[model samples]
Target: MRGTLLFDGRCGFCTRSRDLLARVDRHHRVETVPYQHPGTPDRYGLTEQQLARAVWWIDEAGTPRASAAEAANYALSAALGTTLPLRFYRLPGIRWLQEALYRWVSNNRQRLPGTTPWCEREPGTCG
Candidate 1:
């Protein structure tokens, strides 16, 4: 059940979100790493800009999911002890909504709680 969870380490909002997820992720299925960490994207085969724009989850099958919302639904399903919801969340229409919501958050995260405009400039050192 081990997988990688990549996030924006510099954004306070992102860090806080990771921290909260960490607290509830008792199975340790999710391994948290900052996108800016050395070798992070290369190890996971994700692009730098994509990592900055959204959270990513690398499943055991080596498939990398790029949408933050889909990643979140997976994480939530993992935490919830169920996979039905996550499966549904991945349907084309739902995935589209997830991507849209994720983009909105990524675009406005600078103004979100625990985040600052500077966080966007320094993806690994802002918070």
Candidate 2:
């Protein structure tokens, strides 16, 4: 299934994850877009607040499909042809744990290694 993963470009952790995913996506099964790009939010029918909260995944038709860990796992599964982790992600308690961890990382990413001061700003406009 062809899909797109929209992510926070200004974020060091997210950008690094995007790059790693690109390598895993050898067959080009998914497209990765940075939400910081012009019109990205509008194109995906997402609000800035939504994009800021978590990564997003949309099918080729551009319908909003999932967010946070769900989106990341879907994109990874699509690219790597690995359904095992995807299955793990659906386990009720595991899903909760995954989302909580994802939120913590998202919330603390600016302080992560490789992060620049640009990502530390509110509404980080520069990357």
Candidate 3:
């Protein structure tokens, strides 16, 4: 259940999110890495555009979860050690809802908590 969580390093919001994850992840099942870290994205076969679009998770077996919600679910599952909430994300109608919510938050991330002025001026140019 170990994995790497890739996020934007220069993004204040993303950095704060990573910190929160680190605090909650008492089991240490996940390791957070900034996409700008040398060779990090390349190791996971991730493109700049993909990194810009959403957070990503690469499992120990090299399986990737690109959707932000799905990645979050994986992280939370590892932290909480329960798959019940994750099951809801896979339900027929709920899946789309979860994605939509994630998208909405992602799209407005610059305006959300922990965002810096640089994040506001540039959407995803963090490096």
Note the Cα lDDT for every prediction shown. 0.73, 0.83, 0.76
How high is each candidate's TM-score?
A: 0.77, 0.86, 0.83
**Residue 4 alpha-carbon offset, candidate 2, angstroms:** 0.6
Q: Which ten residues in a row have the lowest lDDT in candidate 2?
A: 115-124
User: Which ranges of candidate 2 are over 4 A from the true structure?
Assistant: 115-127
Clashes of each: 0, 0, 0
Candidate achieving the largest lDDT: 2
List model 3 lDDT by residue over 2-100, tens digit each.
788887777777777877888888888888777776676677888878987888878888767645888887877766667776787788998788889
lDDT of 1 by residue, 1-127 (tens): 4566778877778877877888878877777777777887787777788888888877767678645888877766665567876889867798788778888988998688864333454555422
- Winner on TM-score between 1 and 2 is 2
**Worst window of 10 by summed lDDT in candidate 3:** 117-126
lDDT order of candidates, top first: 2, 3, 1
- Mind giving the per-residue lDDT tens digits that candidate 2 earns over 23-108? 99999998987787778888888999999889999987889899999999999899987777689899879999999999999999
Report the alpha-carbon TM-score of model 3 versus the true structure: 0.83
